[model samples]
Target: MRTQEGDKTVELFLSDEGDEVVIEVADQGCGVPEALREKIFEQGVSTRTDEPGEHGIGLYLIASYVGRCGGVITLEDNDPCGTLFSLFLPKVKKNDDRTINPIDR
Candidate 1:
């Protein structure tokens, strides 16, 4: 619950009924425009130009990693201002009810 004009805030929520884990990150900087939202996650796409050699691969990597882990990531506008990123990851379930042993063990 951070409140700053150019700060980023992250919050995590777990559902009781299922294995759904919700992660939300919100930033209060110069908000992303509607037109570039779709392409923001594409490879080699960056909005920061002040820093030299800054490759905009953050969102791209996030999306890719989440997808590889059988999760989903979405970006949207935060209420009032800034951008909000959401990630949903499903937890793995164990089949055996009687024994809960570590896989390595």
Candidate 2:
């Protein structure tokens, strides 16, 4: 969904979900299409065409980093308009001797 400049807004939310941290970014812009929703995080996939040779890779890198941190990423539709990107990242828990690795959990 395309929104007017006045309607453009980006909202961020961070929440503690027990063992994971929830990070959500919602933007009021041209939302991701249903057809591209699933592949939005894949490499070489992008909706922005205003720039030449500068498409994709962003979400791919984000997904890769999130995965390496033992986290998961999700895409959803924002209310009214736009796309919502959410990342559930594992919290770094510390033990008595040292900090525990998120991946080891």
Candidate 3:
């Protein structure tokens, strides 16, 4: 981690974008390495090595769920440090029959 606990902030932003919703989570920790950026979402891939049993499947699972829901997730470097995760999901709408439908892109 770049900043010690309580020294940095993790920010989240949400906004409505027409048919979709944008969600962003930005942290002020050690930024992800360039070499691992492309494969960060793959299972068994992770940056933290200090933990005894860190599986690194968290992001992979998240990606899987997002894909199934017809949403998209992306990882990027934060402003000065840390990592930023952005998720764009389709908005839910109610049909005339009262059924719930999540917009598909």
Error of 3 at 67 (Å): 0.8
lDDT-sorted candidate list, best first: 2, 3, 1
| Residue 103 Cα positional deviation in candidate 2, in Å, after optimal superposition | 16
lDDT of 3 by residue, 1-105 (tens): 334555788899999999889999998887779998999888889888776886778888888777766799998889888999999988777653434354343
lDDT tens digits, residue span 1-105, model 2: 335566466889999999999999999787888988889888889988676887888898888779887799999888888889999998875653433244331
Q: What do the candidate models score in CA lDDT, each in turn? A: 0.70, 0.83, 0.82
Q: Count clashes in each candidate, considering only residues at least 3 apart in sequence or on different chains.
A: 0, 0, 1
Quote each prediction's TM-score: 0.68, 0.79, 0.79
Q: 1 or 2: which has the higher TM-score?
A: 2
Cα error of candidate 2 at position 85, Å = 0.9
Residue 62 lDDT (model 3): 80
